[model samples]
Target: EFFYENIQGGDFSQTKSFPGLSEHSSNFTLYYETDVWGARLSTVYRSDYITDGDGVSSDADEIGFHATTNVDFSAFYQVNENLKVTLEGINLTNVAEEQYNDSADRIYNVTTSGRTFYLGASYKF
Candidate 1:
């Protein structure tokens, strides 16, 4: 169990409709790795913003889960004892909607990136 809170920037207005923004975020991750394959499970949650001085309020909340799996195909491979290649993957679960905010009179949310791949090569000479 874990928890945290933070304050976000905001603007205030009398006729243009403005509100203060703040957010709280929390998450948990369980990971496991092995010689051939590995997996990780994670969950994230967030709270709506609390208006600073404005009376209005917004409805923006966030909650999501992600799972990632990796494979070490080169665990027992050799390329003539000279050069070897390795491949990797990131954000395999393709989680989305990682951010959210609700305050004053507006609500917004966004997701950055998901499901990426990486490749690497090494030589011993």
Candidate 2:
């Protein structure tokens, strides 16, 4: 499966930041799934984008934000009619990007649990 989206907004302001906004942005995602050897595997990829800020001071407007492609993988296995095993990996690439704070005049990297893995088992009665 595949998906795409676009977002548009007018000029806006924040509590402590410049009066500007990302006029246009977009996102895309792809997903795939299949069954093999009684086990199921799934994968997903996503892309993000953001237009540069506008209507702000020249100094603050210089800052920008964007994201690299991100991927995730997962698998599930049936141990028995009443039991199952599962595994998942998130942010497999440790994707991250820098964000600029106009008011603070600072830049910092933002991320969400970069590159994580999980495993578990479940039983049904």
Candidate 3:
């Protein structure tokens, strides 16, 4: 399944719109399953967007975020009717979070999060 969004920017009295209003954003997923096994891979993406449109004269508020993408994956194997094992990986690529000033120059702030993984089992009576 794939989810997509394309929205018009807001129109303030004196400006085009507010910040963080992206024209395009999407999430795509791929999956496969069998009687005893299942797996899925997905990605989330967002286009560059302004953070504040109150004033575009000299500078804007919050600024704009650069285009970003994140990937994740998961899989599971059924051991029995009520038992299963699962594995998952999040932010597989460790995409960083970045924001720039209105001018699209000079970094405002950049954050990073390492990839994560999980392994577990479940049972039901």
What is the TM-score of each predicted model, taking all chains together?
A: 0.38, 0.52, 0.76
TM-score for candidate 1: 0.38
- Per-model CA lDDT versus the true structure: 0.40, 0.50, 0.76
**Native-to-model Cα distance after best TM-score fit, residue 66 in candidate 1, in Å:** 11
Clashing residue pairs in candidate 3 (N, C-alpha, C atoms within 3 angstroms): 19-51, 19-52, 20-50
Best by lDDT: 3
CA deviation > 4 Å runs, candidate 3: 1-17, 55-62
Better of 1 and 2 by lDDT: 2
Ranking by lDDT: 3, 2, 1
Q: Model 1: which residue pairs collide?
A: none
Each prediction's RMSD to truth: 9.7, 9.4, 7.3
How does candidate 2 score on lDDT? 0.50
lDDT of 3: 0.76
Better of 1 and 3 by lDDT: 3
lDDT of 2 by residue, 33-104 (tens): 444213333333323222333424544533445435556677777767778788887777777765664434
Best by TM-score: 3
lDDT of 3 by residue, 60-117 (tens): 4336778889999999999999999999999999998888865546688998988999
Mark the regions of model 1 whose C-alpha exceeds 4 Å error after superposition.
1-76, 103-107
